[model samples]
Structure formats: structure tokens, C-alpha cells
Target: MTQIDIKVASSEILEKYFIGNELPLEAPVETWINYEREEKGMDVKMKSFCHLLFYSKLGSQLFDSINLDLDGSCCLIGTTILTAVRIAVDPLTEVVYSENPDRNFLKSNNFSYGIVVVGELPYSESVGDSTNLTIAEPGYDTITNVCEYVKCVVIIMSGRPVVIEPYLPKMEALVAAWLPGTEGQGVSDVLFGDYGFTGKLARTWFKTVDQLPMNVGDPHYDPLFPFGYGLTTIPIERKATQ
Candidate 1:
């Protein structure tokens, strides 16, 4: 039954939180800024982002004020810090907003369902025809958050061999998503629990790069994280009591 106290700010950071806004919003900008300035010590030139955050909280509270049965699922944690971190640390949301929604406004169109990919599968250095270890351009081989909001992890490794034993404890899943040409969406379909995570790591991962020239397939190569080794998911469970 308690109301959530709202703080205000001014920044372009709205893009930093929610995405898919193209047409001018109905909320009066000056009214929000003035009220925020007088009561919350808000920045004078209130930015669109601050405006968006303020309105978002205000909108949520307004619904709760009407006693719309907001109990567990609707309760957002307090503080600007939490909001900032959620919008920052989440890879999925970043990917969604990065889709240039303003240009390709999803709302204005007919489709309602949305999807965002936030993880990256590791890819070996790509090769031209020669495969002579020539320098390569950053190919379109990685997952780019293209308008759908989803928190994702990506593995980006340079050509140098790695000693991955220590860091494996912190990781949830691994995918040797070797460098595929222009199939980000297709690969993402597989990794994001979409097409079923069924790819195999193409090479071997040794605890130490020293294991190189020690292939298991042919007298010496081994991998610490063999291909097709990572998966991530959100756990759906009953909320703990306050």
C-alpha cells in the first residue's frame, strides 16, 4: 500500500532506459521540468532521458495510486542507482534500443511481439582464400542488439591462445560460435534458446595455451571449453516475501 517516492533528473538517458519512441509524447516537458526543479533540485535543462524516467515512475505510481492490485510483479526497486545499473548492465535492453527504433519505429508498425539478443558466441579469426594469417576487418560475425531488449553475454577473443580455467567458474555457458559469415540473427536464434543450442565448438580449448600442438582429434589439439558449451536462462520462481 505504500507509495514509491520518485526522484527526477535531466539527461538524454531515456535512450539509456526504454526504447521505441518516435512521435512526440503527450506529457508536457516544461511542466515536468518546473515541478522537478522546484521540489527535487533537478537540472534546469532537463534532458529527454530524465523526462522519460520521471514520467515512467510517475506513470507507474499513478497506476498504483489507483490501487490497481500492484503487489509483487509490479514493484520496481527504488533509487536512481538501481535504475541506472539495470539499464546499463543489461545487454538485452542495449541491443533493443540500438536498433535505431526512431528510424524503424516498431510502435508505428503493425507487429507487437519483440525480441532482443544480448549474447555473443566466440568466433575464430576469419580467413580469406589464402588463410595466411592476414589482418581481418571486424566482420558482421557478432551479435548486435538490434531493437529487441535482452541482456546477453558475448565472448570476444583475439587470436592469441588463452588459459581459461580460472574464469570458467563465473561463466554460465559457452558457445564456440565460430565465425559465420552474415548470420547474426541465425546464430542468435540458436544461442538465445530459440533454435535450440545445438552447435559444437569447432576447435579445442586447453586449460593453458601450452596444450597447443597437443591435438585430441589428431594426436594433439584439446579445448577447455569444447564447442557448444554455453547456455543462459532466466529462472521463473515464486517471489520471496518482504
Candidate 2:
């Protein structure tokens, strides 16, 4: 049987004993052997059995268990459950402002005024490993088309800077949110004005791939966005609801 099948079988066996019972937090190895022999009509001396303790909760909890391997050796293992919480987020409304408003296009066109473009570079497994610095295929093309329709904000999530100079002119704003992982609420907070935008570009954003191996203080050193470049904005206060 596969590992998943084993786990499922183990869980099924354990669930009957776990639910609606005031059993002790830990059970002895002998107890498991007795339970298996009596409940399933098996001879403990002839066959080996596996015992697993399953815990499903939101916070930290300790569990102790012992398994009898095929070689008649005892193995002890501990399992713990970590943090789990749900976050409630409100629906967001999109509003866009242009330098010169187009009334005719706004009435006829169904295109959105505000857009967010997420782009990334080729992923690498190792740190400091060299990979393609250019934003890959479909992402580059998608950003180009979206920017042409309306001024959009582009967010790049990667370990290092990428070549985005071609799409800079059309993009209204650009954010470098390097690998936020599971903390996406933090990004939405800033985008929705709940928080302010006060981040600065740590690395020099090059214009093209030809500028590889470029750094600060190098001769003819020019970049699309220089190091330590950031824009500051004030947080918008949420109005009280009646």
C-alpha cells in the first residue's frame, strides 16, 4: 500500500477510539498491542502493528506514541500542531484617475481603469544562483497589453531585480514586493490605502540585459530606478459605518 493509503487506514482505525472519549493524552505501547489483538482478532507475536496518534487543532499540543515495526523494534515519535487562524477581508472597489479623462471611452469601453500586474523571474532552487534576469514570456506580454489599455500598477515578486524598462512608461506605479510568501494581506493593505507605501528599491533596477554585472559607482553607471528609490504615502482612515 502507498503511504497515503497507510495514513488513511491508520486514521480510520484511530478515529473510532478518539471521538467522544475521555481517554488519556498518551497510551502505552502494550495498550495498543492489546487493543489490536482483541479488537481485530490478531496474534501480536506473529505480526507487527503500527500505531499513530492524530491531532487536529489550531494551536500547539503535545502527542506521544509508539509503533511496533516489522522487526519487533519499538519506535517513538512526537507530533505537534502549529498556528492556524482565519483573517476576514472586506470587498474592495476599484477607482482610477487619469491626467486627461476620456469621457467617450469611459462610456463605451468595458475595460477596467485600475489594474495590478504581478510578474516574476525564472525561479531558482539555490540562493545567489544565476538565472534569467528578464521577466519571462507571457508575463512580459500580458503587462504590455494591460498597460496599453490603462495606467496600471506592476508588482514584481522575485529574489532579485528584473528588466522592466520597456513597460515602465505605460505603468503608473511599480512595486517591488520580493517574495512575500503567505503574507498576501500585507500587500493588499498597502494597495487599498489601509497602510502607506514607504518601500525603497534596495537594488539598482537595470534597463536591459546588456547591463548585466552592473553595480553602483561603476563607470557610466545608469539605472532605470536607482538604489534607495521609494515613494511615501499617507494611510487613509477608514470611515465609521452607521
Candidate 3:
């Protein structure tokens, strides 16, 4: 989350000075790029203000929970999750509960209300096109159709750009929605708004472990989707319908 904080601050700097500041940065996701410290595991260079807004909302939730507990009954929790914002996340855990008939199977389809049992803390876009992704899955030809349905092209590799040479004709815009952390809502926010998608896969999505990119200290440790790519959303006119 702190990484996001830095990105937020840097974005402010980017905004106040870059692109004349008077006008919104044009195609920011691609115009500007900043990848957070890899160790932190978050691309702090947020392409949209929506991410900033979401983090602010999280802060409000934290303050209310703690301020209302002013009875001194609550002690600030400091652990893996340093802040309530960190705790109240959308973690997708793939755990199977102990055998119990009460539950039909291992997991249920309902979402979890995210628990913030105890924690403290604080916290806290673009567009483009270019698709025609390739897919080499022989039997999964339908994936090609799926790509076309969504107007995807230039299939970004989840794992080594899936030898799409044979199926490139089916795509329009392809990207690797990396295994980002819990706050996936941030991902959705960027994808659906004024900001363009600028994220790339942090890790290689390999079909087999043997094909995984090795960290051999080579300068060209290439990724399927080379670090920066984004697009701007098309402006739309609102019309009242009868």
C-alpha cells in the first residue's frame, strides 16, 4: 500500500508539472511510466485517478472504525497487514474447508465480506488499441473466437506469448492481466474508465515450468508484454432516452 502512496505522490508531481498540468495528461499510461520497486510487488504507477479515489475511500473506512472505537478498547494491530486498508482487501484464497456436509462442496460462489478484525493505518488511466493476439491451443480454438468477440488483438502472453503465430488473425487487443494483489477492484477501475490499461505481467505465465523465464542475470530478461502499454478511453456523449 505504501508503494501505492509513492506512486500517488509521484503522480501528483507528474500531474502538477507534466503535460502543462492545465489539461489532463494525454494518454498517461503510455506517456509516463514508473514501476515500483519489484520487492514491493505493486505497480505503483497508477494510470488513473480512480485508484487514488479508491485508496482514499479505504482511509475513510479505517478512520471511522478506529475513531468510533475511541473507548481505547481497540489496540492498533501491526503485522503482515499494517493497515485496515491492507486488511480489508479482496484476497482470493483457494482454500478447502474441512469436510462438512453443511457445505455442498469445498468452496462456495458467494464473496467474503473481507475481515479487518484489527488493524491500523493509513493509505491511500489511458487508452489505446492494437490487438490480434495469437493462440496456439489446438483444441481450445474457441479461445480464438473469444478473443475476436472481445475485439482483442496482439495477444499479450500470460506465459511467453503463447505461440500465436498460427492464430494471430483472431485477436485485436491482448494483454496479460497479471496475478495482481487483492484490490482487483483497482484493476477493474482502470480497465473501465478514462485511464488506459498500462500494466504488464510481472511473472511469466508459462504453459510448462520448464519454459519459464529464468533470472540468469541477463540484461534482456524479456517479458511477454514488455513493461509499458496503455490506451485512452473514447469520450462518449450522454443521451436521455425515452
Candidate 4:
């Protein structure tokens, strides 16, 4: 058996080949070697090492023909739902953040529609997991109160399934936006009809916590939303603003 010192190799690779050198873009197999020789003064020993790393089967697979324009493309993606909703709806739409949200304002404004974002906080091993699957604290109460004034499209942002059966009757639409991370603009893209909703459920959503162990094949399986359940919508193109 042989034990290779990866740390030593990594340090050597970084210091010798990678340090102060911009990574070469997608090009011919000899691009790195040419780049090293022409752009940065190349050492013979370093050239041989780079050849070994670049010309190998794995290295060829790793670096060949990658789209270097991905960062620019991502930058052109949609804006957040908050910004989109405000632009598409009303620029003066009131923004409220409170434990006890004011229902009086909702009634007074008489808005046509509302968006409710409910979710569990980000959890880790040290702090432990959420015990309840229902929307926590003021979120559920707030959503309930808001629905009384205007129809709402609720977006659930948890990493796991949440109990939303109680609020289903009042909700005009529901979206399971499980952990969107930094690409919240994608959510807005769908919400604004720039893109269609094409996602399906990966797991069965139970009506209550009592059905904890239930699955798709269970004899007594009575799911609020069955596995693979999803709704689709056609993309609606927006006219360009003059």
C-alpha cells in the first residue's frame, strides 16, 4: 500500500504552478503550457509537471470546453420576488415586518392580492432541528389574518415538508420554494410568469404529524399532496418598456 502526501502536493502545485497565474480558459490541450510559457515566464520543471497534470485523462475531462461566461449569464438572471412583485403590482405596496402584522392596513388598502412567505429558520446540528412542521409563531397567524383581506399566493421556504393543510382553504395559490439560496430571482421569474412552474414533489406531504412514517406505498397512506404532484404554467412574455 502507498500513502501519498496530498498536502505537500497541493502546496507544491499552488506555489509552483497556480500562484499569480490566471487559470486558462477553454482551449486546446496545450493551452496551459502555452499560457505559462508566453504569459508567465515558464520553468522547464514546472512545464513538465503542468503537462502531466493537463494532458492526463482526468485533467482533460476536468478543464476542456467549460463555459467561462457562466458568471455573466448568471448575472442576467431575474431579480428577487420582492422587487418583481413591487414593480409588477404597485411601487407603493406597503412593506410590513412585525410579529403582529396590522390587519387594519390590509383592509384599508383593499389590495387585489398578497404574497406570504413562511418558513423555518436555518438550523444546524448544534442548535437542533425544529420540532413542529407547522408555520412557526406569528407567520401562521399573520397569513390567516392577511387572507381575510385579500387573496394570497403563499410561498413556503422550508428545507423540509411543512403542514399547510389548515391554510389551504384560504390560500389562492401555494408554492414550495424549498431553500432557494441566492437564486431567489428564479422564484420571481416563475411568479411573474417569465418562466413556468415545472417542479414536482419529491416526497409525500402528510396531512398531519401522526402520519410520520407514511410513504407512497403505505397501506394507510393518505397524503395531503401525493408524491410527484406539480402544477405547470405556460410562460407569459412581458412587453418591453419603452
Candidate 5:
């Protein structure tokens, strides 16, 4: 988390004065082309912001038990949880109940209102157009197992939506923080309830890749989540300003 913090902060400074917005030092198109060609940037800042939002099966139950309200609380976030890290142990177990003391700290407070933010870091250059829509190995059961014993907020960091049907039944809350650009504080900003969750889903999340090609004339059009699928901390109808 600290590493993420540092990277994000620095990226914002760069973005403010150089990359995206109105800044005098902003690079020109020719310079931009060269920069892209070289792929020059920080990985943490490059990451799009995507975190778990709303709640799944464990929704009301979780909000009631732990203080995981739109309000805020301490939480844990895991990364790159695809394959099993230990040959003798389940990969999901490695992440959920790993030897990591931080995980243990949150688990200890499970019944007492502990909050663990956990999920996978799935990425690809282009969304649907590119292949590799799979959620990988043990990632399928990560939320189910973790939520069984701990109060957790799941985050899926990806450039595009991936299948989430299986784990939906157990997840309390999930956020889709697309590669959050170097503003790590935004993660804490939302987690701590400093600000309300205002982002929405940009793509459809399917139950499985088998239901792919979610386009016109595609026979299998059933999606776990459809396009424009999104939720906000404040109801759209009641927001101060829509």
C-alpha cells in the first residue's frame, strides 16, 4: 500500500504538469509519440483505478456486521492472485489466510468488524477485442473463501471486465478500479469514505468466457452483468447533483 501511495502521488504531479491536462510544459504530439513508443512511465501510476463497489450476496449482511458502510474503515488489498503460490496449499488460502501478518490482523477482527480488501489484478491492452478473458486459476474462489471467515471488500483491477459470476454469491462488496493512474491516494480516499463511490462499469462482466462475443447476432448473449452496469455510494436519484 505504501508503495502504491508513493507511485500514485508522483504520477499525479507528472500528470498535472506534463501528461494529460492543461499545463504549459505538456509534451507535444511528436514528443508524445516518442514517449509512447518508448513506453515511459511508472507502473503504479499507469494502473487504472478499479475497486469493488456495491455488494453481492453478502451485501446487507456485511454492512450490518462490520462498519463497512459507505462511511469507511481499515481494510486490506491483495494483488496478482492468479495461480497457487504454494504447491501444498490452496492459492486462494495463501492470499486469504496467508502468513502475512496484515492478513492475520484483519482476520483476527473478523467477527469484530474487520475489513479485508482482496482481489485479482487482471490486465490486458485492449478489452473484448483482445483474447485472454479468463479469470485464471484459484482466483475463481478467492472471494468465497475469504469472505467465509473474514469481512472483506473485493477489488478487481483490470483494463476491462472479466467473468465474476461464481464469486458473486459470496462477495460483500467489489470495486472495478481500472488501472488507477498514479493517484494512489484515491484508493484510500474511497476506502476511508473520504469520498463517495461515483464510478460506473464501462463494460459488461460475463459469468464465463463461454458467454463471450456479447455482440449483435451472438447466440449466447447472457451476461453476468450487462453494459452500463454500475452502482454509486449515493443513489443516482438522490445524489446532490446527478
Candidate 6:
């Protein structure tokens, strides 16, 4: 059995073909950049703060590394030019370290289980709301990995709908526990099946970033979960004997 080499960087792969070659005279710089970005799935906007800080940094590095190999005669024109590009190649040992034990436990037990989401979902930290909020990579990894074992009922404790399209099909159930401020007892109660949760989606939950400007009046009206969509728990309404 041959082990596939995952340690190689994209730049390294490209360099093997074009490192010593001169840039094509007739090749359009903007067209090349656009084509590369599309092929690599890196469509980060230059002016966006979150993208500039996170996704763009690595993408810019990859592009710059390739750009340096181009002939000096080739004119590179873009919104931003990367001064320095850093590349590090390392073999991935473990994708999700913390979830390993849990996965093994689930495998050993082979029983139905539920997932209680405790992270702060797409919510504003300060005076204004933010856009294009997706679950972090680690969180996505954990959820998707866990889902592989068996069906899962996810309870998300966020103030708004999160981008769960890619992972949505894996999840059997979803609960949007929007900021139940101060009182966590209710949230706990719902998780333990002590209380029935009935919360509706106030806004649209987008499926992908391409489906942006997702509002009530948008021309492209497609969401993973539409507005006002809510899942109802089993009718187990019970009151304490007072």
C-alpha cells in the first residue's frame, strides 16, 4: 500500500512545474489571478476585516509565493500585493485531538446519543452585528466527525442562525437556544429532555457564502433553513405539582 504525500504545499506542487519558466507574454495578470483564486477556492475580499485577518493571510502567501517565480516583465496588478509569503509543510497527525476519545467511546458504546452545543453562536460581541459568520474549522471538524458515528441532535446556543449547511444533512435534530440571558436552567432543562423547546428561526440561515446578501427581499432566495422555521420538541408539557 502506498501512502499519499499530504505534506506537500500547493505552492511546492506548482513550483515543480513553473519555477524556472518565464511568464507568458500574452497571459493576462488579472485573469491568471482570478483563475487561480477560483481554482483554489480562495475568494476573500481585500477590504473585509475578518477575511483580511484570517483567510486572506494564508491565501495571499500562497499567491505571492507563485507570483515571485513569474518573470519581472509580467506586470502584476491587484487590489493588494503581498510583500512576503510564508509556507510551512507539516504532516497532519490528528485532525481533531479532543474528539478522538469521544469517537472511540461512541464506537464502543454503539448507542444513540445527543449533542449539546455550548459555544457562542453567530452573535455580536459589541455594538454591532457581524456578517458571514461560520462555525470555526475545529468546531466543524468535531461536529462532522461525531455525526459519522450515529444520528445526533444538535443544540446550538446562539443569538442567531449559524451557517450549518455543509453539516446540516449530518445532524438529525437542531435546537436554536438563542441567548437565554442569565437563566441557564431552561437551557439545561431542554438538553436533558425535562422541557420541550420551541424556538423559531427569526432570520435566514444561508447554505453557502456565494448566497450572500441573504435578506427578505433578495433576488436569490435560498437558505439552508428559511426564516421562521423551527423544530418542535415532543409534547411533554409538565408542571411541578404546586
- Point out where model 6 deviates above 4 Å: 1-102, 121-132, 191-193, 237-242
Name the candidate, 1 or 5, with the larger lDDT value: 5
Could you give candidate 6's per-residue lDDT for residues 85-173 as a string of tens digits? 01222224222223233566657765455453533544355733656665544667667667778777665656656677777788887
lDDT per prediction?
0.34, 0.54, 0.31, 0.61, 0.44, 0.48
RMSD of each: 19.6, 13.1, 18.7, 14.1, 16.3, 18.8
Task: Rate residue 3 of model 5 by lDDT.
Answer: 26
Q: Per-residue CA lDDT of candidate 4, range 120-177, in tens?
A: 7777675636455776667788788877778888898887788888888998999999
lDDT of 1 by residue, 41-74 (tens): 5333222222222344223211111111122123
- Score candidate 2 by lDDT: 0.54
Error of 3 at 34 (Å): 43
- Any idea what lDDT model 4 has? 0.61
What's the lDDT of the predicted structure labeled candidate 5?
A: 0.44
Best candidate per lDDT, number?
A: 4
Q: Compose the digit string of candidate 5's lDDT tens values, residues 21-53.
A: 422222221111011111235332223232323
Better of 3 and 5 by lDDT: 5
Tens-place lDDT digits, model 2, residues 47-83: 3344544443322223333344444444444321110
> TM-score of model 1 relative to the true fold?
0.31
Who is ahead in TM-score, 5 or 6? 6
Give the total clashing residue pairs for model 1. 22
